[model samples]
Target: MASQSLAKIIANQQLNSKDYRLLISAPQIAKEAQVGQFLHLQCKEGIDPLLRRPFSIHDYDRQQGEVAILYRVLGKGTKQLLERRPGQEIDVLGPLGNGFDLTNTADKVVLVAGGIGVAPLVPLAKELIELDKEVAFLLGAANELELLCMGELEQLPLQLKVATIDGSLGHQGYVTELLEELLADSYGQVFACGPEAMLAAVQEITLKAGVEAQLSLEKRMGCGTGACLSCVCKVKVQQGSGFEYQRVCSEGPVFRADEVIFDE
Candidate 1:
């Protein structure tokens, strides 16, 4: 169990039109964070926005005692998070959920990100590199205007690819199109995050290619650590033919991609 707290915000900045980055000094939680794990942030003030907003742990500098959240303003809670200023205190609970698994001895690894889904992968990529894995990352956005945090990704030891729906950037179609091209080559495994539709497409491609995959699901969460059962996603059992629902906050925000049944 982790200590819950009203941590003081150390920094908040707009990253782009729909997204922002917040840095909070949650000392105890930061100490236990792993890649793909998330934080359930309680809005400052009241229960009108009662449920905590789940944000992926973008990065954690344990030595600095800070955790970062890169979030998109999709609704009221997120909007409030975006408006928060430095020094504001907000309640938080986590390092919740199972994160990406990075144990493969595979020489080549592919990571795909779509829109704000890129948040959780940043730290995962860093960890892959530390293990000396060859990492290739593919990122997609609606257009150049909505793109976020390319600079930080580019700084990593990753062979990066970018795509825009309007052709303003790397590829002119969905990121999956680029992924299809990469599949013709030899790669160890694939990891991805994005809209459910996009994740579904990645699921389809990886399944056909016979490539192993892991997916991070995005869902609305309430209790954030399984008690509420609010963030349930249907996933296949790792060993069985039947399916079951797993709490995204606990069994995963991350899961073996093959184990998830993406259709609603």
Candidate 2:
């Protein structure tokens, strides 16, 4: 079951002016957390920022009872997180949201990410590697500055492809272009977590390629729990021709590509 705790911040370091990595000692969450799950963090002491900010579970070590949260400071909630120092306690409720399914027959897998959304994929890639699966990681960001977790990702035993809009890195365009080339090689599955437009494009590409894919969605949530019904997304019903709203917090954050109904 999901529970709340005051996770002790072991280190909260700024990777750059915009990105941060917070390592916390939360045994409860660390052992239970799976790839693509998230943490609902109380960004500040007071209620000025009411809703707890949800960040993808970036990385974790069950032995050490630690979890990492890599986040970009896009708004007030995230901006406030920067002030937190080591030795402080952060209120956290997590290992929430459904995680990506790893039980597949596919041995060759492609991992796609956009900006900070790459957080969950790092762990997913590592886990896939341990299972003796061939993994390829494709990452996209506006520029070199937005690319998160490059150091950790580079250390993994997998193929890495990067793309930045300004041509600061690998390819001079979207990372999907890399996926297109890889599709020819007969990969087993694709897993992606990123911007909506990018996910939609990935869904189309993989569907046309006849490859299986799982997508981790991002949404602004009112309550990290299932209550309040704030973070609902349209999903194609299993038995219907139309769509039905699914709770992104409870039903997913990760859902099969065909199940999601992306806005056109």
Candidate 3:
């Protein structure tokens, strides 16, 4: 279920040079939001940036009736979003898209995030921890400066590993390299959200190891709902030797890692 509301921006703070954390007072959406779900925000008042921008729910405070989204200034839409002040009202269509399924019997779960893809995984980590599941995180970025949200992630009770291309951080390589090493320990399941290259590597690693893995994808969307047919990804069908285009906004943003067909 989804709801549309004019939510008040309670807090909008810059996390880094490019990324920001936006907290909004939207109880209806917060209560219904799940890990891996997103919110579609009408960024500006005018029609200049007419279409809404989709942002993953970074974290949500159920008791406080608030939801937060982590985003970076990538274009006109997000730049407009950044200019919005606290107490300003923004139209939010929320708690959308299919989220990660936590019902599996995976005692040891691993979360892999690349760049700002760490957003949705925050809530998923919290939920998994609450279930008494042992969890670990492999966070990677191009460099230390691009690595976002380390402080918030450290507050959780989980094993954390960092990787960077410039060797200014934990490991001096791709996060997938760290993941490969960790996979040797035999994690029951893995959840990943990152660039296509990262996800493809994760898919190969998980497939070879016979581990269950879910991947969250990022795409340009026209409508957050399925009507616009804007955000679609190729998914491998279960029964056939063919692939089908599935709506990333409605059918998923999360899909089985092995089922995703990444462009080479």
Q: In model 1, how large is the Cα lDDT of residue 27?
A: 81
Clashing pairs in 3: none
Alpha-carbon local distance difference test for all models: 0.86, 0.90, 0.90
lDDT of 1 by residue, 36-64 (tens): 98898986555544747888999899998
Q: Better model by lDDT, 1 or 2?
A: 2
Worst 10 residues of 2 by lDDT: 43-52
Q: In model 2, which runs have C-alpha deviations exceeding 4 angstroms?
A: 47-49
Model 2 TM-score on a 0 to 1 scale: 0.97
Q: Which stretches of candidate 1 lie over 4 Å from their true place?
A: 47-49, 238-240
lDDT of 2: 0.90
Q: Relative to the unseen true structure, what is the C-alpha lDDT of residue 233 in candidate 2, on a scale of 0 to 100?
A: 94
lDDT of 3: 0.90
Error of 1 at 109 (Å): 0.4
